[model samples]
Target: MRATRLNLMRAFAALVIVTLLAGCGFKLRGSNGSYRMPFHTIFLGVPDTSALGTELKRNLRAADDVVVLDKAEGADVQLVVISETRGRQILSLNNLGRVREYLLTYTFNFRVMDAKGAELLPATEITLKRSMEFNEQEVLAKEAEANLLYRDMQSDLVQQILRRLAAMKAPAPQASVPAK
Candidate 1:
């Protein structure tokens, strides 16, 4: 009886913890794409062939009731990619002078503008970084690992941008012109 009671208590504790987390709006990274983009139609400035552009489109597709267009024509808003830059620096060196660690950084600058060219979001920058240890014997593996870290940072950047878009109030309705 005591063992059963202890198990029940543990389960109840876990349930309470989950509830609290939900109430506080805590979510796992990239687990949920529940944000709704304010714009009904959006045109991404980045080229479709780019990896970052592809991921951004994929995530934006999950936004409720939003249309992502292949062409800028007929789009209600445009998302401009100001710039994207990556950097790597030696974080540390081994006793023998080989690279022991590297600091990886991905910087993204972007903004949102309406069809009328009014800024919904001024230029904003989000930088993500990850530090990884290097192994001389695993050059190939380390390169692959570094690529993975960069991808992870890209995903993070997308999420942050999505959140910002969702937080903004929907753009003021544009006045429609009467047919001539």
Candidate 2:
């Protein structure tokens, strides 16, 4: 009878503690959730890089859990690309007038910012490309080539963005010294 009464008291105490904790709004987020920054809301400002901006927004939407916004209105971060350059080159050719080993390059500036629009990752350029045989006979095939190249470029851009996000690190925790 004593043990049962003690157990009941313990259970009542535990319930009271849980109720107090719940009233205080203490939430037990997951492990990964603890490290997550308040980065859910984002604003994208691309200037003349509108096309690339659209592609970036799509990639961020599909690959990241961020919510993109227009301008900096009610956002946690801002992503921007300042400039971009695109070029193409031919790497191979056949004796029968067939061209092969074409390469495409795209260089661009990127930046991440806080809600106040302060730069987090300073302006930087990332370049990516794709190369393939150039066929002059089939225009439809050339169109396919362009599509592939664009896809590669988008993939590369997405990788670069994710890399930046992963590279973010919080400040190191301070150590406490024990007095001898």
Per-structure clash totals for the candidates:
0, 0
Candidate with the greatest lDDT versus the true structure: 1
On TM-score, the candidate that comes out on top is 1
Residue range 23-100, candidate 2, lDDT tens digits: 998877532222333367667777545666776677556544677787676776777768777778888888876675
Q: Between which residue pairs do clashes occur in model 2?
A: none
Per-model TM-score, in order, reads 0.83, 0.59
* lDDT against the true structure, each candidate: 0.88, 0.70
Q: Which ten residues in a row have the lowest lDDT in candidate 2?
A: 29-38
Cα lDDT tens digits for candidate 1, 1-180: 999999999999999999999999897864666786677888999976788889888888877888889877678888899999999999999899999999999999999888788898899999898999999899999999999999999888888888898887677777788999
- Candidate 1 residues lying further than 4 Å off, grouped into runs, are 1-31
